[model samples]
Target: QRQAMANNSRPTPTMAPNNSLRWERCSMDIDHLSLHCRQHSHTVLTEATPVPQWIDDRVSLTQVLEAMQASPMHVLDTEFERVRTFWPKLALVQVALPARNVLIDPLAFADLGDLGRVLGNGRPWLMHSASEDLVALKPLTEHAPTALFDTQIAAALLGLGSSLAYQKLVQSELGVSLAKSETRSDWLQRPLSAEQIDYAADDVIHLQALCDRLGDRLDRLGRMDWLWQDGQRQIAAGYELLPSANPHHEFRAAYKLPLAAQVRLVAVLEWRERTARSTDRPRSWVLDNATAIDIAQNPPRSGPELLGKLANCRAFPRRQVGEVIDLLASAEAGAPFQPAPAPLDRETENALRQAREQIDALAAALALESSTLCSRRLLEARARLGTWPPDCTRWRQQLLEPLVQATLGASSPTQNP
Candidate 1:
């Protein structure tokens, strides 16, 4: 009986009219939400949604390409895995156009270049948080957002929240709560659960509504350009070395300057990045910041030299030390490509902090998780870029950056907030 209750204790009317699943009577209160999560934690995992027969192998790449080619650019999201692996396994793909919705089964047909075109050269898309989705798509295609608008960016612009999840954004924006049951499901599973499929599709279902609300808010405030800037920033951040780009490419070239310091900063960061790749671990795990900086400051040309002063050397194999030295030498010999520099200004910095507060407060007012919508780092990057947040990063621009810009005189006031 207890087991049955546990299994059956899910949201009633298990599926929504839109075929998406939702949680029942979820509390909006922060404490209550946390308590409820800790209690019935099984469901609150990941976007484990259902996969309809239409999305099977029969769902040809031709059909997808035809749709993508015909439709105005669309908003997309994806889920993947990166646990002790060289490549992040593609899990699910959520595509949201103005009038239609799609949930692609990556296990069925992973590649989408013939279908999905990214890179800021196409129609605008309304992605939520683009970083994860972008990284996941790297193994599949060179999908850089052509034209982008992150809903999370928009939410920030509206001062709704810093960073919010699609579910939380939907609830706050449309008063519709989503289920958390599949928040951590094994997305690679073949026969996905009915509940899981619903959860996955739900990630992009309300994106159109999200875009409508955020677009209007951005326009009303005359901060549409903020959307473009956010998109560009996301693209700059979204660039991931192809699985083959350099197995050891630091997850990105982020530790270049202000983030890292010195002339050999890029070389040191790249060395650590390649080391992480060869080991198939995160850059942070391979070499912590302080040690990386120290080693970078004084490069070791020989394996013995590298293993000499480094503290984490013991953590790695001695044989790997030689390879590490080689990589370090190579990096030192060549320069890493730097993305357009992120500018710094006192006003934008202050704006970033104030917008973070404003967005957090607004999220509380709407009963949403601020982190799900936007983040301080993303906001800071946006401000530094001195551009409007785009819409393609899963409403991130709407929910956070616009409001931040409004405070910074980077954007005008909107009617919504």
Candidate 2:
């Protein structure tokens, strides 16, 4: 969650027209609707059904779980702080079911494993820009969600901008501008103010209806199945590099370095990862990227020299500096550095330029973003290596491969490596 605090400011449950109300009684209270009202401001919120309940215990969680199971879909959102931690510190979780919306306080309720089971039961989970929420949900659920309906991704397929904000998306599609007064609030603090609670609730309050609208739009366009497949593809792609032994996988900018520097970078990053995990602190707090890269590039010969080289190294135990020095020495001595293959030659480089031009034209013609076709890095890699990423889905290949191959030419010298 972004710390962009401003002020934020629910619906009633009713029985279905044709179905009996035996199993679906509205248990959440809506008498305190002013809990969501703005006291100081004159802004009037749009009328919506589905009252919210503040849930801070196991009983409330069970109640919400049963209600969610009764509903066909649910909206989910989370508020967390990640300023100085490797993992998100989950503070609040908002779940909006058809019957009512509820807030889950993770700090007060420690055992949420059952709630996780409910979320992981293959029911559709509606969220906006779900990547970070997916990370936050993993620790609670013991696994990531398999069924996702990301409103942002769905909107993108409908020709809305790919990076649309949640508030903007709701306003554009639903015409309701959410107040952002609490975007930067400290969610971990106890005794949350009414304003804070309202702000957090606003995150998921409109999600259920928003998902329904987007779903209908996608279905009419005959792209609903494609969106579902793409959601799964996104989940699979996110987990691809997460389990890698390469500690430097997240440092995308560092990959452009020479082969030997890359190896040394990996060594330092691996040590940093272990240290951060052990201490439950951020990797930067242990040794930031710049300092690590400096140590890797210019190894320190002695303990005193290491101290001199790293002014910020005092944060960690002095013994680790000695260990790092030894690790660098071992790495340097164990292997003779060999550079990776060169980038595209002159002819291939020109062809790659032409390919990008063609891709841009194709994207414009198809009313899609260039990134929706393929990322620049992926295109460059394909141009250089003469092959696509193994994980590229069949749908994407159908759209991209023929054009790329035509641009590469049949007799091109850049064969698959």
Best by lDDT: 2
Total residue pair clashes for candidate 1: 81
lDDT of 1 at 13: 18
The sequence of per-residue lDDT tens digits that candidate 1 reaches over residues 176-211 is 688898987887876666676666667776665566
Scored by CA lDDT, what does every candidate get? 0.56, 0.66
Off by over 4 Å in 2: 1-46, 237-259, 312-318, 332-346, 409-417
After TM-score superposition, the amount by which residue 398's alpha carbon in candidate 2 deviates from its true location, in angstroms, is 1.5
When summed lDDT is taken over every stretch of 10 residues in candidate 1, the lowest stretch is: 31-40
Question: Residue 70 lDDT in model 2?
Answer: 69
Model 1: lDDT to the true structure: 0.56
